[model samples]
Target: MAETHFGEWIAAHYATLWPELFDPALIGATVGFLAGLAPGGGSALEFGVGTGRIAIPLQDQGLEVYGMELSPAMAAHLDGTGVEVLVGDYATAHMTRTFDIVYLLRNTITNLVTQDEQVRAFENAAAHLRPGGCFVVENYIPRLRDRVFAETPEHLGVEEYDLATQIAVSRHRWIIDGEQREFSSPHRYVWPAELDLMARIAGLRLRERWSDWHRAPFTAASTDHVSVWAKPFSHSRAVPNS
Candidate 1:
């Protein structure tokens, strides 16, 4: 069985620990962007929909929202939030009904920690979409070029990359409430070109790439990206775009 990096401690205190991500403006902006892509009354499926941060509000916007989460601890937070959840890995989980849009956000694809799993995640998203529907991914660009490590008064972290394996290991330490907390995880970092290739292998075509949810142009200097891919309406098994 697949396991989750986020566990009980992380789940119970997520909103309090990551207050920046829980900001109303940020959630509103993210939900607004996703809402625009989904037609009125359309359905959506969120891959790694931890705590329903975006799903609950998006559902409130009138779109039916479904979530796939690997952590039961995390899914517990969604109870009574009106967002239905499937407890399983997004990389291979299946839903009975397709959705108008499928999305993976916050660099969750990297959490797969292997190229094969990441590819399967893209395929899974395509499989869950209706014909001509869209799949969106929000991910941070690799910071290897800028620095290998980051440090602050409250937090410290370092990343080690293996170019040949396309894997990165990150170890982090934080001073929270005057105590020390630490975590380490391995991830596979993929470039934009590589992600596009994965989309093609999944029978999706690139629709747009932006620097942010606000639709700013993606540039070489940008630190993050939001990409959208569309499935062909003609056939479910159409030849992969060349």
Candidate 2:
């Protein structure tokens, strides 16, 4: 996390990535509501808030939104956008207040390379929320059955796997048609039940899970998921490392 090289790369290319990611016809509002931001009004805190792509639109819909971005390179675009951005490492961020909803989108949690770091982040997120707030995570399902290794931008594919630990990795390299050199990064992948355990340890519980932001049924064949974990008013607590 020294300088967030990958984030800089992404920020530099957002002109192209933004269209692919943010032009889903107000998908941000759709996801914000799913994260428990009421139609009336509520606050949202987004982790990995790259370039304010999702946040700016969510704010336009009337949600009081804030962002915690790990990369200044990516966050620079948020300037004068009216969104409160906190730039720092996501794992050990200094969140002074709580929000009604906390969300990590686009497999952002996987940026942490280890299980312990990922679990600690969940615990921190649980701690940084008001009672009854919800934690929403959108991530891909590990489908590394036949793809133990692959390349991207070069071949339009994704792949990675670590045996004996069940930790999958997303390996991608973007050597597009006219890019100078290749840009790549690998992110960890977590299973469905593993997320439940993380929620349980943080005194939260799974509330709603879907195959997509549209609330499609999560099935055996779904490639991704949007999972919600609620911090119940009656069960607010936290578990620390032993």
Candidate 3:
């Protein structure tokens, strides 16, 4: 089984821990981009929809939004938000119905921590997408050249990567009220080409890839990416060109 990094403590202080993600401008931009794809009464499914941060606003934009979450504590934040919540692992969960779009945001894909699980996540997303539908993902580019470090008066964070295993361990320690608190999570960092292969294996084709939500060009210097893959209209085996 995969480990769930987000739990009661993380849920309770989610906003506090990641305040930058709550910015209205960023949220608006993200919703605008997604809403553009699902025009004309289309429906959306958010994988790892934590705290209804984007789902709520997207729903308010007249889109039918559903969520698949692994943590009940995090899903609890969506109470009465009108966004249907399915408490289960997004990588392995099965839904009876399909949607116009399925998305994973904020580098949440890395949480799977294993290549097989990540591939399964893509397959599951494809399974939930309607014909010609899209599976979108927003994730950070792996920065193996330089290590990650976060330092503050109240907190310290360090991320170490193992090239052989492609495992990145994020370790953190926080001092709140003069008491010590610590947490760590493991992630399997994947390259863009690898993700593309996974999408192909899932019977989806790459539609677009950008450096950010603004549709900026993806270049070698880019540190993050938002990629979209579309399911073909028919699942029948493709015939070779004559």
Candidate 4:
């Protein structure tokens, strides 16, 4: 039997949710530049196009946006949104044509749950990108201060990292209006250098990286990064244009 999608619990409430949680408009506008979202612009593919929150807006900005969604319930929200959605794992989904830009936003890549799958996700993105196309990733940094556990509304606990494997396991818990939830999500928190290596392994090169959606410069103080990698114009050379 097929496994239920991770967001199934919140899928029904996704569209109307999170308005004040954060600003999607600003995020869309900022990502537009990387997606080539403009009048008669090139095409884009979003790996996890949940509820068309970002894809629809990007489509409105003139990019031909398509999506790969893993949840049927979440994909149902995309109906009549005009942005095409493919239902499957992005690591192995098939499409006839390539795109000008492919993006995985909002830390969705972590949902893959394993480093191998994460690397495969990059490979899939590389396969779907045209020469000179961009692959954009946005995810948070693992903030491992001395805190044993995070006590926000949503619960998250971090155990010590294993020295040999370099993997940090987090115990997560959530109680949404008394509907208790608990789970563990294993993450291979990737550094910028590691992401660059992944991109290189997938035949892409890092072009630009930013601290946030507002084009802020990335520094040690930054909590996350928005990075854009490009498919090389010449695979033999594997060099990016200046």
Best by lDDT: 3
Which of the predicted structures, 2 or 4, would earn the higher TM-score when compared with the native? 2
lDDT of candidate 1 over 1-242, digit per residue (tens): 34687899889867755666788888888898899998677899999999998998899999999999999999999999889999999999999999999999888888898878888998999899999899999998988765445577766777878888888887877778898988777878888889998898898989999998899999998888999999988775544544
- Displacement of residue 139 (Cα, Å) in model 4 is 1.3
RMSD for each of the candidates = 1.9, 3.8, 2.4, 3.4
What does candidate 2 score in Cα RMSD to the true structure? 3.8
How does candidate 1 score on lDDT? Answer: 0.87
For model 4, the superposed segments whose C-alpha errors exceed 4 Å read 1-7, 15-25, 35-39, 146-184, 237-242
Q: After superposition, which runs of candidate 1 have C-alpha atoms over 4 Å from their true positions?
A: 148-152, 236-242
Candidate 4 residues 117-192, lDDT tens each? 7788999999999888889999877666643545666444454554365456666566656666665545556667
Estimate TM-scores for all models: 0.93, 0.86, 0.93, 0.82
Candidate 1: clashing residue pairs, number:
0
lDDT of each candidate versus the true structure: 0.87, 0.73, 0.89, 0.74
Cα displacement (angstroms), candidate 3, residue 69, comes to 0.7
Model 2 — which ten-residue stretch has the worst lDDT? 148-157
Cα-based lDDT at residue 125, candidate 2: 80
